[model samples]
Target: MQDQNSAVTLADAFNQATYIIGGHGSRKVKVLQEALEQVDGETFSDHYGNGSIIDEFQQEMAEVLGKEAAVFFPSGTMAQQIALRIWCDRADVKRVAYHPLAHLEIHEEDGLKELHHIESILLGEANRLITLEDVKSMKQEVACLLLELPQREIGGQLPAYEELESISAYCREHGIKLHLDGARLFEITPYYEKTPAEICRLFDSVYISFYKGIGGIAGAILAGDSDMMQESRVWKRRHGGDLIGLYPYILSSRYYYNERIGKMGRYYEQAKELASLFNACHGIRTIPERPVSNMFHVHFALAASEVEPLLVHMAQEYSTAITSYLNKTGGNSCSFEMSTGDRYDLVPQDKLRDALTWLDGEMKKKRF
Candidate 1:
């Protein structure tokens, strides 16, 4: 059997093939033109963080989120950590509540604790969505509560809007600030049947990534009241997040925002159709069984050892890539995630199904 590193290399190979959307792979020249064309007169932000494309994008995001103001950061990690620190400072509690699977909890390497001296009170089960009851049960004094819309780590699961409303109310009554880790905020709007402004009204602060679903190179926006945003700019500078010129990231995000924001509803609908196709096949299962957003997980009842070659072989044979990577989940099972977008919409459904059917056939042949 090949080593774990080899499996990652095989995954990289599939990315080079024609795929129906996994990453933000449109033509390189097209992406460049889209970004450059957006540049009108000025292309740079002022010395600290003001005046050009950066200010324009921040204003646009704040309007979309219905917040008093917004600030852009180099990354969601910096944006979220700074947000939590601000809340914790205001309340003087230094403790926050969130799911164990939140990106801040799992991916940030304890930056909150190490840098800001803030503590996290983990809420809910690792595999399930957090509920109102989970917050009610927290015994400690938490300065804030952080919730990820369409929770990323556990197959993009989302709580009912009613439940979310209840949680929001609960936080307000308890004097706990509510913050949204809304990296995929745009992707969940279709399910809520609400505008982004309407949804964001429930939280004290909201942070959205420019790169994930929006397909920008990199950057994040943190939106809140004027005071909070003003403070965030200070934090952005202290953390060295204030770049001299954020034109490229800003322009790309704006370009994709105009082009793809309206297409998210279509992407969500297509994802549901694709999920139904996968559920019908043997030896394959989709998490949550139905996708609540543009993204979902697919599990295969085969080892990475057995599946990587098939992925490579299928890409070569069909001149198309079905998926870019599959991570080892447990004993013999492997899992990968999919987020639907323009490239996915391009492929004919029958051809997409044929690819999955072929994968199922290969896995079934190994059973006997």
Candidate 2:
């Protein structure tokens, strides 16, 4: 147990908070200010649907991905559901193959099952990035296949490009439509010297989240051939994603994608350096030797439940904010996510120790 009195925040110790995970928020507020200027409309307006920022956003995304078209959906869930539903509808099949931990599977509260009326065949192992081997190994008759790049369950581990090629080749040979759940696709580019468009070309359709890596307020775009993406716009309307006005998300996404898109490399480099710091600690180990993108898991001696609140409190009290976390499973280990911000050795360890030592003193109170 961490002694309640022993932890300290960044403010108290070094006047800086340590962020270990999550996208860099608000680096360019000017971009947001630029968007808000023309955002006068209803919360989710859709009556006129004339030049909705959503359309503009989609057009920009389409160009970025080198696709014929793109459709903006309020949520990745809707975007992805539409992709699978369309694939199933086209193939006249009702099944989709995906990793068990894919967001569509584990998250979403079974929305795909209840709403899409499609069955999902979970085709990968637990806590591992599914490889081409995993894909080839599956015996499934399905309408389409979904793969989450940088598998979230495994701290953003991505399969090699060769593996991606092999899996997509197999799918192509079988006439299976491939849909990529590219929620964090930006991160994958660094691992492989490929552009987003190049990698996305493998899949028939690709869904990218505006909020995750790009740091937008919230939105998603599904990109594919002109006809497919145009058809998706219809599905988007059916699923209530065709909002009359989605200017805030549109503006934010434009700002993020334009200004913050290329920072993934910097973030990943920081994660590697931070990983070294965590590994140097007495009771810390990385979930994977190398992080696939800007994220990785750090196992600790403390329970995540206990560590999380304290980390927050310490950050608040002293100024070190721990951005992401993983509570352990069946063990005393907790996995902490460290972003590049903390990895920068700006604050000396001795100075941080004062706050941490203070936290140690304070955490003792929680024990009782």
RMSD (Cα, Å) for all candidates, in order, is 2.9, 5.1
Best by TM-score: 1
Cα TM-score of candidate 2: 0.82
TM-score of each: 0.93, 0.82
lDDT of 2 by residue, 72-99 (tens): 7789999999999989998999999998
lDDT of 1 by residue, 24-100 (tens): 57546678676777466554454568775577778999999999999988899999999999999999888999999
For model 2, what is the alpha-carbon lDDT of residue 34? 64
Q: What is the C-alpha lDDT of each candidate?
A: 0.84, 0.72
Residue pairs with backbone overlap in model 1: none
Superposed on all Cα atoms, model 1 deviates from the true structure by an RMSD in Å of 2.9
Model 1 lDDT, full chain set: 0.84
